[model samples]
Target chain A: MRATIIHKPGDIRIEDVPEPKILRPTDAIIRTAATCVCGSDLWDYRGINPVDEPHPMGHEYVGVVEEVGGEVTSVKPGQFVVGSFATSDNTCPNCRNGYQSSCVHREFMSTCQAEYIRVPTADGTLVATPDQPADDLIPSLLTLSDVMGTGWYAAVAAEVQPGSTVVVVGDGAVGLSGVIAAKELGAERVIAMSRHASRQKLATEFGATDIVTERGDEGIARVKELTGGIGADSVLECVGTQESMLQALRSTRPGGNVGFVGVPHGVAIDGQELFFSHVGLRGGPAPVRRFLPDLIDRVLDGRIDPGKVFDLTLPLDEVAEGYRAMDERRAIKALLRP
Target chain B: MRATIIHKPGDIRIEDVPEPKILRPTDAIIRTAATCVCGSDLWDYRGINPVDEPHPMGHEYVGVVEEVGGEVTSVKPGQFVVGSFATSDNTCPNCRNGYQSSCVHREFMSTCQAEYIRVPTADGTLVATPDQPADDLIPSLLTLSDVMGTGWYAAVAAEVQPGSTVVVVGDGAVGLSGVIAAKELGAERVIAMSRHASRQKLATEFGATDIVTERGDEGIARVKELTGGIGADSVLECVGTQESMLQALRSTRPGGNVGFVGVPHGVAIDGQELFFSHVGLRGGPAPVRRFLPDLIDRVLDGRIDPGKVFDLTLPLDEVAEGYRAMDERRAIKALLRP
Candidate 1:
């Protein structure tokens, strides 16, 4: 089967890989329907994260189960399902507490960006709909596996309450979707930081009440200005850079929260600053499993179309192009159909 | 009037100073009934935080209102009152949100070490009882002004839930009082890390269900072991060292909270680790104004006695002894009578 692999910085390739099969009692083999190049994928692609060797490329996917292990009861063969970026046993204490990303028995699903992928702990990791999803819903459903769930988690972690003034500090799919999440969660105002005109348009369409074109200090200043110098009630940090983290921290009002979904890189928080600000910090890898069910429901009800983030698409054989498009910032996200 | 002053590391002196008087329209002059040396005070005494020049020593106090400025309203002359370590204009947005320590118009009350201290923003900073408290309640009421309020803020910031497991990462008066706050807030289990036998006894008396004499890594491991391989649901960090902060982070379960009330020295948090752990971090200087009224009620009702933390007492002229006792670790906390 063909899969996306990174040989080194700026060198992603589509190559033949062994087909996946049920490896554990709770495993399920999925025939990939759609997968995408994620914002996080750019971290390794740009070599910011060392690519030690050729590694699997993506973690988001929507697919039909080709086979299921004897212990897999929740999902069966031929059933279409969406899985979280991090697979979990779901019964673990962490998963039970709705933090599946930190589940004791967890597995990254990056291998899912291929013709076939094996999902472990299938019964607890995969969420199947009542029936096969219609063909047209594939793109939107694919988003539920990661980007959508991640966005929702960011909003929830930020504690976006009714009448909240929310600031989203990334222009990628997750940040754009965060705007949607904040709106769905009842935020009175959503401010999206995006220099890209296209993303800004989508942000406004998705419910961003304001868009700040500046970055870093200027961005924070704009947010504070929009909030009457009090800063936003909640800040969603989607870009894991030090500047983004600091902006997120400074953009929140004293006693407000900064929910960071960005994978931090070279970001070190000064304890004194955090202490003096009294801003609550909480986030992490999104507990996508916890939000998958709700996100799928929203998709099915036509309440959100997160698939709009995918501005480009390609065949599995051209997966490298998908990575290139996102790496070069030509597209917000790229979809790969297998 | 006499006051305690830190001239240099290991050099504390009792010197005559001008008596305080109302300096602002919102100020109130209080004759100190009791003022105690705090853990933070030891920072300057030990020279971890430099004492550039002789500076007034204490920030915690309970006293009798000697005089009130023309604009003072909530507290008046001849009334028993407890004021926080930091005085805040309680009408600000931050204060309205219960983060009085970060109020737009906040004032530090470190000069309280003197025989007479002037409290700024008196109407918003001091909480008075219905009548003069009996002598027996003075010490406990004094505790409410800082240590107890700080402990309560730690517990509240950590979001201690009913029946949750709580771990307190310091054994100072604030940490010991945190055990009381945790129990009062309905924590099912409270673990206190204490090396001293006296502090251990006080912690246990304050409803600490477990005591671990270990520090840092081993201490966190012990807490995890005690929680059945999972960490505590809430951790109160009352010690501001890097090790204590990291230990507090590592001792909390994923999705749990770490409320820090310590005045940070040089603590730095690795964002990646904090991001991956999914633990919530919230804290800072205690918004004592928010907790003062409730704590006063508890002290007045005899429901709690925090005065036990004060093991040594001295006249204002002998304030140097109080500083030495606390600095030498001979007393958990010391009280000064003026």
Candidate 2:
């Protein structure tokens, strides 16, 4: 089978890889129906996060089960399923507590941008669609694997409610998805931090009531201005940087909640500042598998169109191009069809 | 009036000080009935947190209103009152959000260990007791100014509820208070991490179901072992050191909450580790004023005895001994009568 591998920074190639086989009794082998290049992937592609060696790429995918180990029961051959980038045994204490990403038996499912991928803990990690999704719905369903669930987690973590004033930091796919999540969760107002024309349009279309083109202190100032100088009740942080993290923290009112989904890089928070701020901080990997069922229902019910984030789609063999397009800001996200 | 002043580390002197008088329309002069040395106060006494010059000591107090400015309304002369260490207007956005400790118009009320002390924002900062009580209730009421309220804030911030297994990292007055607060809030099992036999005794008396004397990694191991390897549901961080903070974070299960009320010192948390931990962190200065009403009711009703933390009491002139007793760890806490 062919898969995407990064030899080093800015160097991605499609090469032949061993066909996936169920190695464990709880494993399932699936044929990739849809996959995508994630915003986080750019960390390695842009040389920010070290790509140690030639490693397989992609963690997001929606697929049909091609085969399953004898012990697998919940999912079977020919079933279309959506699974998160991280696999987990849902019965663990952490998983039961709704933090599947931190599951005791958790495993990162990489090399998913391939013809076939083996997923461990299949019964616990995969959520099957009610019916075979149409081709048009695959891209949207693919998002359920990561970005959509991640964005939803951010909103939920931030305690977004029916009348919450929300501020979403970042205008990428996840940030835009958070706007949708905030609206679905019934936020009264959502301000998206972005200066990009296209993402700003998508943010508004997805439920952002306002868009601020400022960064850093200016961005915080704008959010405070919109919130009557009190700051937002909930702020979603989607970019993992010191500036974005501080912006999210400062953009919230004392006793407010900051749901930070960004994978922090070089982010050092001052304990004194956080102490005085009184804002609650909570976020990490989205337990997407825990939320997959509800999110899939919403998608199937036509309440949200998260697939709109995929502005470009290419053949699996051209996965490198997908990365390139997103890296150069030519597309919000790139979908790969196998 | 006589007050306790810290001329340098280990040099606490009883000195004549000017009588406090109402300084603003919102101010009130209180005749100090009880004031206590706090764990934070020891920071300066130990010279870790510098005492630059001769400065009056003490921040926790419970007293009777001696006089009020023309505009003071909520509290008045001859009223027994319990107030937070910090004064707030109770009308700012932060105050309205239940974070009065960080109110925009905030003022730290120091020099409280004296015959008379001035309280700013009297109407919002002080809560009167139901009735004038005997000296027996004075100590407990005094804790509402800081320690007890701080412990309660830790529990509330950590989202402690019925059946929660709580871990308290510090065994100081605040940590001891947290045990009481956790029990009052209905935690099923309260764990106190303490090495001191006396402190451990108080912890169990205050509702700690278990005590683990280990620190750092070993302490985290004990907590996980007690919780079926899942970690505690909620952890209260009352010690602001880096080790305690990290221990509190590592001792909780993913998705669990860590409510920290310690004044942070040398606590630099790695963002990546915290992000991966998936534990929620919240807390700062306890919004004591917000919880004063309920805490006062509980103390008056004999439901809790937070004042037991004060193991020694001295007349106003012997205030220096109170500080020295606490500094020497000869007393868990020391109360001063004026």
lDDT score, candidate 2, position A191 = 95
* Candidate 1: RMSD to truth: 1.2
lDDT of 2 by residue, A108-156 (tens): 8888989999999999999999789988888889999999999999999
DockQ of each: 0.88, 0.79
Task: Name the Cα RMSD for model 2.
Answer: 1.2
**TM-scores of all candidate predictions against the true structure:** 0.98, 0.98
Model 1 misplaced stretches (Cα beyond 4 Å): none
Residue lDDT tens for model 2, B11-124: 888898789877788999999888888999989889999888899988899899999999999987999999999889999988988899988889898889888999999999
- lDDT at residue A50 of model 1 (Cα atoms): 91
Q: Model 1 has how many clashing residue pairs?
A: 0
Which regions in candidate 2 have their CA more than 4 angstroms from the true location? none
True contacts kept of 1: 0.88
